[model samples]
Target: MLLNMNFIVKALLGLCLVNSAFSARILFVMIAPSLSHHIFFRHLIKELSFRGHDVVSISPDPMNDPKLTNITEIDIHTETYDAFDARKWLETVQYNKPSSEISLMRSFLPLFYTQADNVLSAPKVQELIQNKNEHFDLVIVEMLMFNAHLFALRERFNCPAIGLASLDTSLNAMDAIGNPTDPNYYGSFFTEFSGGNLSFWERLQLLWHHIDFRLYYYLEYLPISDAMIAKHFNITDKTAWDLEKSVDLILTNTNPIFHIPRPKVPNYIDIGGMHMRERKPLPKDLKQFLDDSKQGVIYFSLGSNVKSTNLPAEKRAAILNVFRQLPYNILWKWENDTLPDKPANVLIKSWLPQQDVLDHPNLKAFITQGGIQSMEEAIRSNVPLICMPFGGDQKFNARRIADLGIGRRLPFDDITADTFLDAITDVASNPKYKKSITKLASVLWDQPTKPLDRAVWWVEYVIRHGGAKHLRSPAADFPWYKYLMLDIIGFILAVVIIALIVIIKVIKLLFRIIPLKKIKLKEQ
Candidate 1:
């Protein structure tokens, strides 16, 4: 009997070793604590596991899912930054003017620097790098993750890395590759939308911001990141580590159909619809409510960070008043219990299965803060939107959706019951909005394979190909000025100025000589 037990234990141990050997290991690093940002990568991770990849995620907390059998969680806690709590900060700036609000937000940029610094300095990260046996073939890191981690892993593990950005891929990541962001838009390299359509003042603002970003990167983020990498990895050769050497591919969560035309680098892949795939069963009660409601459901969520309950009293009252009148059954993602006045049409819950709700046939419209992930889901579900954008890129995303003719934008402060009613009524009654969203949905979902499959395939491709070296951008060797076309512009400007001065001098000399010759001839 003792021998039988011993034999069973040995067999089990052997099976475990064999399973570990065959499993393809992947390391995914994300810096987002907010649910919105984390949601963007959830499907991608699941898909990797589905494809038989052993996925390890470095995140602030473990994912709530029980079926994520292959996923291992690594804690990466970030320092609490004031800017991250935008809702609380906005309350402090309530009395301030719009310009003041914008200025204050800019001033708080240091918070991100501090947060990044704290994340990069975490001892766990250093320990992970030191564990020589736990090497990853490919490292998929969020853009907000310390850039130093990318550098250190490439130098230490000698593995290829890819960037996953929740926002539209900007110049910061694209410039690492050969692609350049457009300057006319906020993320654009040449454009500034001070108030839309480049004016002289707008041009100056754009130029100033461009210079500011470059300076901030060099003076603050780069130096701090470099120091962290050096300290963690004990590397002195700074020149050897470049963004290009570290990042082989960039996967942006932005659809090309929504963005303006721009040159795409070979290494940059726009896998926007990766997060929009169908989810499993919704909660029974929620699913039943949606099915029972003869009228379409109006889904309201302020996203993960900013709670609707935290809104100012007047704003909350205004929202409640609007909700009271809406005929549609409301699924409000209210984090707090006991709203002052509850409407019969409204069903308030601390949380809702957002994607599942969106996927439901009864969901008529999404009333949102226009977070990109939410917007993408709404688009995927062919649901029109009433976007009351709060802050940051929400405004930009709202405008984008409105521009696409699938939604309407209502400022949070200015939203009234009438406006809300009108917007919802218009979206529900008008077939065009639904038609447009349906069109976008088709475009977003028309890929040859599932987005998850594609994402997982590429991840494995990078691992199998030993870091996709063929896709690495050659431009990583260039300086910032060279990458931005500033160097070329500066040279051209200098040459033009010199030529103008030379021409002026020649004109003056010719005039003086001609007059002198005329006088001499007349006297003779």
Candidate 2:
């Protein structure tokens, strides 16, 4: 019996090994110039390589890890940044206004075209495309403002492709995937209004914004992208819009904890915090600072794109004045080497391990620019927030954070020492903020599978099945009129109008006949 059991165990082990050996060849393209964006996607790329799949990654930031044997990194860092200067663009942001969310779709149209053309025209990419031997089982491209990368799906690789976003799904992406964009219920990511509890006027504004943006995207933006993509790929057959619609799946960095809950097609998956991992040990000075802070620490950062050094001198002084009076020790992610009149209770660093710092036991609250990734880190660490939004979905994130009772939102441009002090002290001392975030963290983590695992599984599922076409919503292929059933409504209205006309004519004819009959009777 013992001999038979040993043989059975060996057979089971062999079967498990065989199942784990399944791997796919994937083409991953992420050309966005922002490091925060790349940081979120890097987790998936490394995870796939570790699982033994062969991955060719074209990205601004490559893993460059010698141990990632299965990954072939093609660096496009210089090409992308040269086309779009992120820091210069950020410096131009208007911070003094109540609404910082500008019309990026309109303002950045030329930059998008430039970026797409530059990446596609790069020599490395050209060689990869020209090489006839190059093939892939699946293709994954960043689905942000640029669509030129999608050309690889049909023009080059001729395989299944997936769209990935480092932020919440934008209006353009929602339309591409045939996901429902109910203006009344679901506001666009760029909009300041959160989904629920909108007044009538707000709803109308949301509706108008939705229609105006969609029309601009289809009529104006898409044509430019299509032209650039066509020119680079040397393709005459299909437009860039066609390739975007053909994407088998979209993996977005969004979650219901902070995002508005809405209906989604099977192909769109939320893997928001996939980049989050086990916290690492903080550097010696940083660890000592946090540990020694008897009153607790407040972490502040404006994310990768926005720099604190770019703040107006007056605004900087106002912020410092508030920090000087606060009892809490402050750790600010300052970009510059020096902060004039640096407070005794404050520590400034050009860079910090954000996640590790947030997880510290001495952390009281986080004062942030309210980027989605920063919010996710704060929530995962069960830390409350004081959100001072700078730009680009930060306003919306701040609103949601306040609505959820996990934090407070303050205007960055209109900051005063008194208001800033109030926000800091309220969030740091309030028990409700801690309780709300703790409860939310529990809900956010109560998933059947870890987000990264789910993302990898879906990527492999596409390879295994040769595409997730079966999961694609029919709404994606439907024209605007057909999807909204407007054609059917119009047909019904036409039939009703014709029937009313015929009935009125019949009544008039009967009246004439009855009057003629009465006249004949009188003559007789």
Candidate 3:
């Protein structure tokens, strides 16, 4: 009896130890206050918490609702930018050309540097790091904008970190891990599609743009980042600043069907449709609106950054006039209550449940500014789109969707009631658009598991496997010259030059010897 009790106690202790070892605490950092980014991170946090992981999020504000109980919120106020005023910057960009934009970005680098500095220098960030009593097993960081925060956390925690790219994980993070972005892939930020096929001068401009990016990141961004990390962690021997070195895994919120094939590192996981999970319930009014709309519904949203209310009066009037004439009920995600005129068929609200509205069976078409999250939701729900891309990556995303035959792009400046009506009419009346969307939806869903599930499972898998060291890409350690294949090409060119030189010398020597021998024979 005594022996059995002792054995049971020992077994219980071992089990407890095992359980403790397997448990993980993950910290998520997000900088953007945009709704799309927030929603993506919110779903990920919820999924992680559901899997019994301790998840903490650091962002400008706690965007997640109160329902997400398990996730702790750390509020860090980074520099705020008016997304509306960006239109002025963009107008300047267009007028001055790409080189001017590069120069503008170079000028703007100091602002981002200052923002990163402030966030890192905050008392809360410092307190979090110094509080040795608090412990974390892993760090998940949103890899948009500045990477300074990520580096700071990695150096401070010295734990395995993962990157969560809210947009398609093609260029920025994937490039860091040796995955070359395919120029043919239209949606990739690095592709010719991003800047359009350029002439020699334009190409030079693009090159300058890239160089500008590198310079800004290395000179302004990296030093501030490294300084923060060193100050907090007390590490003096910092060498290179490779973001891939700081992260153990990268989970992209992009679907494979939408992206071109590229070599994926072991640690890189594509979890594109992670935001398509079903919510518990729709608001009663929204539900009734969907049910009441016998003629089907058209959803119009400019995403988080570009507000419809903020549009110039002419543009706003054009859209309003178009919406009034449309036969279908319009659910406009308007940020303001007062508009010039409200049509009987139009429902204007400060905000709407975007995913929920998209999921409604009556939702026939989406008129959008071509945000990736909105596009993903429309694709997932088999709804066609009329893309009016304003700026930034929206143009690329709009073009890709249009190329897929599931959508059409209309420039915001060129928008008129007739054009808007015609575009919306075509998307609604045409069976081809619905067919294409449905086909893509089938492809998106054909996977063994849902995207959100895969994301959740993999995040937990990282935790269970003791920080997923196997997923770290070896290319992260390679020198830039080697990673870019410049060194290999240089070596090959050098060898060819040396061989040509040797051959030329040998030929000259033979010619000289033969002439001398001929002379000697003639003399004899």
lDDT of each: 0.71, 0.85, 0.71
lDDT of 3: 0.71
Better of 1 and 2 by TM-score: 2
Residue 330's C-alpha lDDT in candidate 1? 91
- Pairs in clash, predicted candidate 1: 182-188, 182-189, 183-188, 183-189, 183-190, 183-191, 184-190, 184-191
- C-alpha TM-scores of all predictions: 0.83, 0.94, 0.86
- 36-130, model 1: which lDDT tens digit per residue? 66777877887777666788887664485778888887666444332254455444443343453335535655665565556656677656877
The window of 10 residues in a row where model 2 has the poorest summed lDDT is: 93-102
Query: Each prediction's Cα RMSD?
Result: 6.0, 2.6, 4.5
Give me the runs in candidate 1 sitting further than 4 Å from their true place: 1-23, 64-69, 77-106, 117-123, 145-150, 185-208, 239-245, 279-281, 484-524
* Candidate 2 residue spans exceeding 4 A from truth: 1-21, 87-93, 96-102
Superposition TM-score, candidate 1 onto the true structure: 0.83
Candidate 1 Cα lDDT to native: 0.71
